[model samples]
Target: MKIFVDRDKCQNHGLCAISAPASFQLDTDGELQYQESFDDEHIDDIEDAIDSCPLQAILLHPDAA
Candidate 1:
């Protein structure tokens, strides 16, 4: 699956990291970081992250569908 985050819309809220720590993270500077590509097994967590994001900055590529 492919993941993309709209940096301009993101607020660094860290909810995505809480929802899917394996795929998303907040660095020491409280900035968001994530994997662009991940294992299919993490789909549930990735979806959870997407749902939890207040800014709706996360998106899955069409290939992820």
Candidate 2:
């Protein structure tokens, strides 16, 4: 799956990180960073992150590949 975050809509909250640390993280600067792609095994975690995002900035897309 592919993950996209609308930076303009994101508040840099760490809930995504809390839900899926392997896919999302808050850098030392407290900025949100995330992987653009992940293996199928990570879908559940990524979904949790998407649902947990308070700003609803997280988006999930089917992998084009």
Question: Roughly what TM-score does model 1 have, to 2 decimal places?
Answer: 0.92
RMSD of each: 2.2, 1.1
Score each candidate by Cα lDDT: 0.93, 0.93
Which regions of candidate 1 are displaced past 4 Å? 63-65
lDDT of 2 by residue, 22-63 (tens): 999999999999999888898899999999999999998777
Worst 10 residues of 1 by lDDT: 56-65
Tens digits of per-residue lDDT for model 1, 1-65: 58999999999999999999999999999999898988989999999999999989999986634
- Model 2, runs deviating above 4 Å: none
